[model samples]
Target: MSGSSARFSGSTHLLCCLGAVSSTIVIAMPAGALARQAASPPTLNDPSFDAALPPLDSAAPQPAAPPVPVAPRAPAPDPELIQPLEPIGSADTTPPAPTAEQAGTGDATLRIRYETTVTGLAGFKTDAIEGDLGRQFRALSALIKDGNKAANAAQVKARADEDVQLAQRIMKAAGYYDGIASSTIDLVPGQPGVVRVTLSATPGPRYVLNTITVTGAPPEPTKIARDSLGLKAGQPVDAALIEGSEANVSLQLPQFGYPFAKLGDRDIALDDTVHNADYVLPIDAGAKSRFRNIQTTGDPVFTVSHLNVFPRYKPGDVYDSRLVEDIRQALVATSLFSTVSVEPVKTGVINPDGTEAVDLLVRQTKGPWHSLAATAGYSTGQGATATGSYTWRNLFSPEGALILTAVAGTQEQGGSVTFRRSDAGQRDRTFQTVLAIDNNRYAAYKADTADLSVSLSRTSTPIWQKRWTWSLGAEIVGTNEAGAALTLGGAQPRITYLVGAIPLLLGYDRSDSLLNPTKGFRITAKLSPETSLKGGKVSPYARTLLLATGYYPISPSLVLAARGQVGSIFGTSVDDLAPSRRLYSGGGGSVRGYGYQQLGPKDANNNPIGGRDQTEFAIEARYRFGNYGIVPFIDGGRVGESSTPGLSGMRYGAGIGGRFYTNFGPLRVDVATPIARKPGESVIALYIGIGQAF
Candidate 1:
């Protein structure tokens, strides 16, 4: 046979089989990608697929058209048309033909961008609900969410009926039982593969609740249970809200002495004609219980008398689980115990009064029950330092503790010993006294100080989510500075100051976390009055300070942190006040990007002189990746020599920092540059520590 005749015969054979096509050949896809693509009919040929086929000659003798049957409507190109036909077999050493990513020359095979926009859902704002209906509807389901290729038009059309049913089910779930939905898939005329699936819906009238019935009660006054429940007869019927009534009963019972109460069977019936639902819940509240005697189990750190002072409920009082939880939280806040639990004995035992006894189980932290830590740190501004601390807990029989801490650093060195006493009568009041001696070197001057103080702190949480604290204290301090700059009106080369004072402070904290907070805010204010203990340079004066910090999470991994501080000392000159008592700024804890005390006012000889008034503001945008974070920050501050505050002497600092978060706290490192530095000041600084700078 001639070569031309052979080619014609082969072509005719292919058309004969195509003409007789009736059954479909299912091409198995990789089991991994289960969602098939939905592609519209091929009104236009894809030029890319034409290159993969064998060349057909236009000059070849024609095969007559009568032998090949044809359909009335245009047929969509087979999805398999564009796929590489090379067989995938175990014998091939070369990697299965490069996936789109491996090739990098193109994208995953046959990808098309399509979105199933639902027009009928007006009031439904939830993305999850919208996605659910999209996945259930067949026309949209074949449109893969991954933006990959689409399935053939035949497959999409076959599921049209299922899509209608899916829309009906969606409406019923949303309390529109009488709603009707009609949908159609129409191709965009000029586009080759894109199709729009439009769903027109008439949401029937919403159904309201016909009745909310409770089967058995008596755990409370019955009125309390009804009031707390979210479902009401006149409200629209929401399956989620109706089901929540059972949970409400369970919660309300615990507040009324039935700690072990539970809600039983629930029946919810929907009526189509009236468009209303009947929701019924059965509650089983066990015997009424009262508080009996309390007992403690397991080894405890505090004395029996000290522990006894904590139970707020009396033997005859009604049982309140909330009180139990509050007491548990109170004990946990002490930071002395590793574990704490308060619960009913759970034994079947009942007293003559039919009351149930409770137990407090506490596991004290492992002994030696004391802490001894050695610390070392450094900064470009402060050079290097070494420090140590010895803490004895449960001192004086677990009602108090003694802590002695000594720190010797490049610019500052001090030692302090404190005795702290906790609420002796469980009144939430704590008392502390400190005797300290320190020799400090600053950018201003070097001084030696002897100090003594006693303070009282009372704390309360009016709203369980937040804390409030009030404190009052008294202090006496003596200080001597050598070669310090003269005060605005005082002595020139040397100064000695002695003062006795009273201090008051109020604080509020609602931050969600202590070491790393992403929400909430904290604010604290303090006022202290001082008088000359041994009149030399010191004068009677009042000092006030205010601080505020805020944290907000813009995203799960990003946080916005900010802080502001203002302080003033009235009735005293800058030189008369001890350096430790005067307000100062700069360093890692104050404004970054400046040396310690660099942002504040300077003395005549270019030394950092303490200021009577100070103000500072800082902001940081921190983005975290797992345990690490990058923070870019800006800090601005001013220091004035007088009691009145002004913008003069203002300095600006800016930098980027890093955080390595650990189980204990974040490890902080900051690299900064001064934005308003003078010729004599350092241009750059580095600081390292544990926890956020604030």
Candidate 2:
């Protein structure tokens, strides 16, 4: 047969997500399945991507280290062994662009079938092998998809030989030295340029790690890196772990002042009979170097004041790549730059004392960038509301901005202008001030308020990572409430009084993400002490609140989330406390089963009157399907007139909700009914908004 007529061969592997669980792998195959192979598949590790060559020497067996036991894992659903073909390895870049005629057709039609199976290796190891083999074949198949795949019969036969070589390499990589890969190809009877192919595998015994040897490393300094190698004897021989350790050895040197560090050699000795694999690594730690000055990209907008605040190391300090990264993060966090790169600039031309110079490159943001935000929310108590805000960035500096916000709803309608500044370096301490007027319709009363306030806050994350936030602020509040009705003392409504107040808040967050959390806990507490300065009103008072939220993931796609809150007011009667200042519950953020502020005691008019104390609790079980979530939740809340929070007469609400996850946040909609309804309260309520209810 001519070269063009012979069968061609290729190897490819991909993982397909069984029903779920394992990080799925996907494989593409021809309509007919795998055909013939070229040769023993090429070595598993492509030479171009492997470590600098000259394979290391093999040696006699050495004592092995104790093994680390890994927990068992459930097997993933079997993969899709066959599927319609999809383009792989990207479109081949080798040959000149294929003409339409050639484009419509590919090398003779081929298909791949995986018949590889094994036992004895349990849990992650078993699943790991399956994923690897799938990916390997996927790549091999991709190469054959190239326009230049053997065009002649004899050439195709040669391609088959290459396929054998590739499969052998993959088998070895899987610790299956004795395994075999086989393929059979046939010409389709009625289809021209089409071929039927079948590929199968026999994965043999799994090999375990025997020993590891490290050479060329300074004993004292390399101890930690050497000790922490995650691989252990008795562990399934995994090429990935060995490669990663080899890379780690190379990195450890540079981290400790070695500027031109290198991994000299890597050796893997495989023993077929004993089914054991041993690893050896050689390291080269180049000369130590000091760090010199930092040369910036010279964007003037990133003022020295901004740039100077983030330098962790000065000239003459030990060279640390980590410090360079810190500088990069600081620059990026300032939101002043659109791009940032911090790296060594002159290690090649080292200083007389062997010092390396570094550079911090940045690109400044331009223009008066603006963003608009819109919001719509609904609740059983407040009905529905809408809000809008516009923000201007880089108003005065990179970290300065102003926002204008307006809101109108059943409970409140108002507008405010806020100015913010946050240039306090890496900790992200910010200062903000706001001026506003609003009509607040509380369940207990209605309020007309005018307010001015400024606050400063800092959020910091560090090693041992407390992940806490701290803030302190003061405000001037004046309001008239209770429909200008009588007060607790039965006197005229408490109104027209200037109150000077200061607030201190402390918060800690450990959630993976702010908008939606799968795991972790967050807690926030605030204390506000106010003094009345208006004539005839000496109602000095203190308010305190504490809240905590927790998330526990039951599975990759399921979570259990909960929140609890408690609050109290002291040194003032419920009537003396402004409507907005009093504690209340029964809303989406509180007890969802009831109306907004509906859980607590009511006033003479059967209207919600703010309470001196409030408590709330909520629990939700959430299941996610890709980007969407379904949640069933239950809530309980209590309100009281006593200064101390009372749990009596607690109200309960339960409901189900749907969430559509998005880049910005999750869009949520829920329908709830009061577990124990009051005669006048509505029977059902619907709420819609963004982010988790909390």
Candidate 3:
């Protein structure tokens, strides 16, 4: 075969396959004829046949239909357009790094924003339920909690789906059992990549209570238990309220002498047609009981004998839960227990009055019963002091504590050992004995003193503040003190003195809090009568002090507080009294801007000589925001040479303070300056401590 003929045959075979023609006709011919035939390619009606073959001999090629315009092949989509998802089941469980889309590439539209709405509710419920739904739904919080990072479309849809279920639950809690919630996630119109999530809820009519009933409760406490529940017919059938009220049924019975009361599950019958429900609560209220024998259990620090004194109820006395709760609080105040419970347990014995007798059960779990604490404070005149204490709360058991305390400072150094019994023979009462020795160096005088004291007191704690409190005590003190001579330039000899005193105190507190009262008032009066033997000359004197403080809340976050104090000495001349016993003011606890004992009478050498009378007044405006507070305060005080406390030489201090509130109390920093500058006084005095200054 000729070369031209072979080319023609091969070309025809390739074109046929390329065009996918169903039929082909092949004829052998002379080389010249074949060439001529090939030059004029076979023409068919099929568009593919003509296009697949290159024109033979450009000159002789039939005019091809105007070249069908072909669009330029689109470039392979940039691999960076949509980030490829990371393969699953990888050994590395760490999430793949976010793409530019996820990171929101400087485009606000890329990050998903969501909104929540509650419909078909009025008054406060609309705003309240809307807020609740926002918090309940993950779709609403995820972007915020995650710093508004963009989520993939799939993830966004998944969160919206979950939010629908949460919204419905929220509505049910608000008494709308037939509420429906739906969520939609869609790209914002005309804004590509900007996804919007909407969580919508339509609350049907709220169900109301048709009848509220309680069963299995005895006559005496049945009324009380029902009253305590605070639920009534015609009230909205709120799930949260129902659950809370059910708990009150069991709680109220025990308080009313039904010590063995047990509440069972509640039953509710709903009528969808009327949108109301019938509710029933069953309780097991045991026999009416009176107080009888005392029982102690668990890891109790107190014996049955010692424990019996804590409860106010006596044998044959009707049982009361308030007394039981008081006993529990008293035990907790001892700081000796990790857990404590005081309950009445059935004794199974019937009294002559036909009432069952129940034993008082005290259960306790010991916690860390020993502690070591240290505190330090500083002021312009008082300098700085560091105090440390070691306390063994259960040293003698039964709420007895032994404390060893030491104070070391620039002006004073002392140590003391104390034994205290809490709930001593009576609730909220204490018996304490102290032995102390100190060497003090102040501008007024220098003394080396030893003291022994015994006191019986009813004191208040931060946890259990009492309305009335009192204390009576006796103390004997021996000291050798050196003071300025009677005459200028005379010998200053140290005097040795023995002092005995009977101290009494009475206090009434209407304040709501012990350390941080916002409303109410408190007043305390202290009196001490003493006899001092100095150089074999006996001098009898009486010392008295009165203190009062009040707090008023102007707003939820602002409090107005004021304090006043007065002190006096009688029955002895100031010259004959012990220097340390003399009335004096000025310190962090008195006049804030002055040094310790700086405001009293001064000697010829310009040193404070102390005085027989003192008076002080302070006022503060405390404003708090969240856990922080700011206080502006003013203080004024004076010391007198006579028994009468007056305004003569009244010194005033003013300052602002800052507070950081904590669970325990407010931590405060005060910066005070004397209103009228005095020679040898600091411009600014700083005081740092816990709780309020008052």
The lDDT leader among the candidates is 3
Residue pairs with clashing backbones, model 1:
37-150, 37-151, 38-150, 38-151, 39-151
lDDT of 1 by residue, 1-694 (tens): 1122111111011111112225689998776757988998768588988777766774567777686676699878888997777766745685467566536736434433334556565664222334433343433433333243444455444444345555665555555556676667787688866676666666667667778776677735355556767676867654445446556667777777777776665665666556666766666666667765556666667655676666777766777778777777777766577676666655455767765644444444434648898877667677678889898867776658889999889878999999988775655778889999988776666788899999888755322333788899998887876644555544446567777889999998888866777899999999988876334343788899999999999999999999999888899676567666778788888888877876676666666777888899999998999889999999988888888777776788899999999986788899888885778877788888877877
Q: Each model's TM-score?
A: 0.61, 0.70, 0.80
Looking at candidate 3, the ten consecutive residues that score lowest on lDDT are 6-15
- Residue 413's lDDT within candidate 1 is 91
- Write model 2 residue lDDT over 514-538, tens digit each, in one string: 7777899999999999887445868
**Highest-TM-score candidate:** 3
RMSD of each: 18.7, 22.9, 16.8
lDDT of each: 0.70, 0.69, 0.79
Report how far residue 532 has shifted in candidate 2, in Å. Answer: 3.2
The candidate with the higher lDDT, 1 or 2, is 1
lDDT of 1: 0.70
- Kindly list the per-residue Cα lDDT of model 3 for residues 1-694, writing each as its tens digit: 1112111111011111112225478988876544443466765698887798877776464676798889999889877887977778755877676667656566534455543333333331422334444444443444334443344567666665665655666666666667776666666687765666766667777777888888887777778878988898988867667767767766777777787887776667666777777777777888888888878889857788887777776778777788888888877877888998987777789988778989877887888999999988777777789999999988887778999999999999999999998888777889999999999988788899999999999988888889999999999999999875666655456999899999999999999888788999999999999999998999999999999999999999999999999999999999899898998888788888887888877777677888898999999999999999999999999998899888888999999999999987898889999887978888998988888989
Candidates 1 and 3 compared by TM-score, better number? 3
**Positional deviation of 228 in candidate 1, in angstroms?**
7.1
